[model samples]
Target: MNQSNETTMNPPLNQESVSLEPSANLVRTIAVRERPANPGAWSNTVAFGWRALLKIKYVPEQMFDVLVTPIMFTVMFTYLFGGALAGSTADYLQFLLPGILAQTVVFTSLYTGVTLNTDISKGVYDRFKSMPIWAPSPLVGAMLGDVLRYTGASIIVVLIGLVLGYRPEQGLVGVLLALVLLNVFGFGLGWVFTVLGLILRTPGAVMTISWLVLMPMTFVSNIYVDPATMPDFLQTLVAFNPVTHLVSALRGLMSGGVTLGQLGLSLLTPVILTAVFGPLAMRLYRRKR
Candidate 1:
C-alpha cells in the first residue's frame, strides 16, 4: 500500500525526465528566437538607405524640387538679372549655372532634416529604434539616399545651362568633379540640419529656421554678384563665407580657371562641417527618447 501510494504521488523517473526535456527544449528555443542577430554596420546603413529610397517610390512628388526647381531658378536668374549682373543672358548663364547648382544642392539638403522631423513626430523613429541595427544607420542612410537628390539637381542645372549656351570649359572631367564636390559639401552640411531636426519640435520649424539661415548665405555670397560690387562690410562677410569658396571653386573648375588652392579650400569646407556636426548630431540622436 505504501509503495503504491509513493508511486502514485510521483510519476516514474524516466517519464518525469521525458516531460522535463520538452519544457527545457521549449525554453531554449524561445531564448534562441528572442535574441536578434546583429548585422554589419555597412550592411545596416545600406539597408536603411534602401528604405529611404523606397519612400520616394510611394511618393514621387518628393522629387519635385530636384526636377523642377533647378530649371526654374536657372531660367529665371539667367534672364532676370543676367543683363544687370553680367551684361547679357549668355554671359550670365555661365556664371549663374554653377551658383545655381550650389544653391539647389544646398537647399535640397533641408529636406533631410524636415523628413527626419516628420518621422520623429509620427513615431516612425520609435519603430526604427526597436530594430536590431546600428544606431546611426537611419541618419547615415537618409543622408546617403539624399545623394540622389543632389546628383539629380546638379544634372538638371548643368543640362539647362547647356541648353542655354553655358559650356564647361574644363570639359567632362571638371564638370564631374564639380558635381562630386557639390554633393560632398551638401552631404556634410546636411548634418547641421539633422541636429536641428533631432532637437526641434516640428518639421515646419526646421524648414523655417533652415530657410532663414540659407537665404542670406545663398544670396549674399558670390553666387549672384561679385563681392567687389557689394558694400565694404558685406564684402568682408562674403569673403569669409564658405559658399564663396565653394562657388569660386566650381566657377574655376567649370570656366577653366581652377587652381589647386581653390579646390583644396572647397574640399576642406565640407570636411570641417562634417567633423563638427556629424558627431554632435549622433550624440543628440542617441539622447533622443
Candidate 2:
C-alpha cells in the first residue's frame, strides 16, 4: 500500500505527463483579463491629495492651528488694537480683517513644509518616492491638500471679522474673489517651504527656519500698519514686499479700491516664487536620500 501510494504521488517525468504548456482551460482563463491602464498624472495627484486629506482626518490635531490661530488673531487684534489704532473696534475690523486674512494664509502656508518634513522624518516619503506613479504628484498633491487648510483658515478669519463688524464693500462676490486670490498666493508661497522641507533633516528645523523668515516678512509689511507710517528706508523695503502687495490687494478687494497694478504686483511674487522654487523643490525631492 505504501509503495503504491508513493508511485501515485511521484508521477514519472514523461512528456505527456509533465507538459510545460498550460492547459486550454487555464490559458483561456488567463487571456480573459486585460491589464489595467496606469493612472495618469492628474489621477495620481488626486490620489495623493486624498491620502494627505486622510492624514489630516485621522490626526485631528493637525487642524488645531488652522482653527485656533486665525480666530485668536481676528478677535484679539480687532479688540486690542482697535481703539488705539483705528478709533473703534468696528473701524479697526474694517481695516484689520483683510490684513488678518492675508496673514493667516501666509502663516498657514508654512504647515505644508512642516507636514512634508514630518512625513520625511517618519520615512513615509521614501515609500512615496518608490511608488510607480507621477513623480511630482506627491509634492503637488500635498500642496493641493494644503490649499484647503488655507481656505479653512481664511474662512474662519472672514467669519470672525464679519461677526466683529467687518463688512466688505464688494459683498459676497468680492469676498469670494479675495479668498480665491489669497489661496492662489498661498499656493505659490508654499513652494519656498516645500523646498525647505526637502532640504531640512528635521521637521522642527524646517519650522524654525520658516518662522525666522516669515516673522520679518509678515511684520515689516503693511499687514499691521500702513507703509507710510514706516521710515523711508522701511517704506522702501515694504514697497518691495509681496506681502504688502497682497494685503493691499485684499484690502482693495474687500473695501473697494484695488487696482490692476496692485493685482499685478501681488501676483508677481507668487509667479516668481513658483517659477524659481517649484523646480528646485522637485529636484530636491527626487534626489533626497
Candidate 3:
C-alpha cells in the first residue's frame, strides 16, 4: 500500500488586520523641500573673506611677521641711526614713524601673494574654482581680509612710535587718515603680488620675487632719510619712486603739511598699479591650470 502525505500551508495575514504605528521610523510618503536661492556675489565674497579670517585665527603664527617686523624696525632704526641722522632718538622717531608705517604695510602686503600661491599649490583654488560662487570672490575676499592685517601692522608701528616719544602733529585725525591712505595703497599694490601668485610655481618663489621688488622700493625711497640730502642723481631717482611720494604724503598728513599735489602723487602709482594688474590678475586666474 502507498501512503500520500498532505502539506498544510497557513493563510496569508489579512491586510486589514496589519498595523504599523505612525511613530515608526519608516516613511510611507516622500516630501520635497524647496531649494534655497543661490547666494549673491557679495555674500559669496564675504563668506570667503570669513574663511581667510579663519585661517589667521587658526594659525596665529601667520601674524608673527606683522607683529615682530614693525617693532624691530621701529626700535632698531630709532636707536641705531637716531643721533647721527636726526640729533636725537626722539627727533628721529618723529621723522621716522610715518615712513615706518608705510614701509610696514608695503612689506606686509607680500604675504597676500604668498598665501595665494600656497593655496594654489595645495589645490585649494581647484576646489574654489569648482564652487558655484562668483569667480573673483576668493581673490577679492583674501585681499579684503588682508586689509585687517595691514591695519594691525600699522597700529603696532604707530603705538611703538608713540611709546618711543614720536608724536603726530596732526593728532588722531591725521593718524587715522594716514592709515586709510596706507590701506588703500596696500590694496592696490597687492594685485601685483596676486598676479605673481598666479604665475609663480611656489609660494617661496613668490616671496623671493616680492622681496626683490620691495627692497629697492623701500630702501631707495625717503623712508629712512631725506631725499634732499642724497646726491642729485639719487634724489631724482627717489623723487620718481612711488614709495617716496607715499612716505612724503604720510609724513605730511601726520605732521600737518600735506598738499593736494602730494596726495595726488601718492595715489597715482597705486591707481596705475591696480588698473594694470587687476585685469592681468583676473586673466591669469581664469586661465590658470
- Structural similarity to truth (TM-score) of each candidate: 0.85, 0.87, 0.87
- Candidate 1 vs candidate 3: the lDDT winner is 3
The full ranking of all candidates by TM-score, starting with the best, is 3, 2, 1
TM-score of 2: 0.87
**Taking the tens digit of each residue's C-alpha lDDT, what string does model 3 give over 1-289?**
1222211232233332244434242453334355679899899888888998999999999999999999999999999999999999899999999999999999999999999988766577789899888998988899999999999999999999988898899999999999999999999999999999999998989999999999999999899998889999998889889999999999999999999999999999889988999999999998988
**Off by more than 4 A, model 1:** 1-38, 122-124
Candidate 2's displacement at residue 70, Å, is 0.7
140-215 per-residue lDDT for model 2 (tens digits)? 8999999999989999888888777788999998899899999899999999999998899888898999999999
| Predicted candidate 1 versus true structure: per-residue lDDT over 1-289, tens digit per residue | 9997877777787478887998999989888856557789998889878988999999999899678988999999999999998999999888888899899988999999998888766577788888778888989998999988899889988998999999999999999999998989899889989999998999999999999999998998999988888999999999888888899999998888899998888888889878999999989987787
Model 2 spans with C-alpha error above 4 angstroms: 1-34, 122-124
Clashing pairs in 2: none
Candidate 1 to truth, TM: 0.85
After TM-score superposition, the amount by which residue 201's alpha carbon in candidate 1 deviates from its true location, in angstroms, is 0.9
Q: What Cα-based lDDT does every candidate model obtain? A: 0.89, 0.89, 0.90
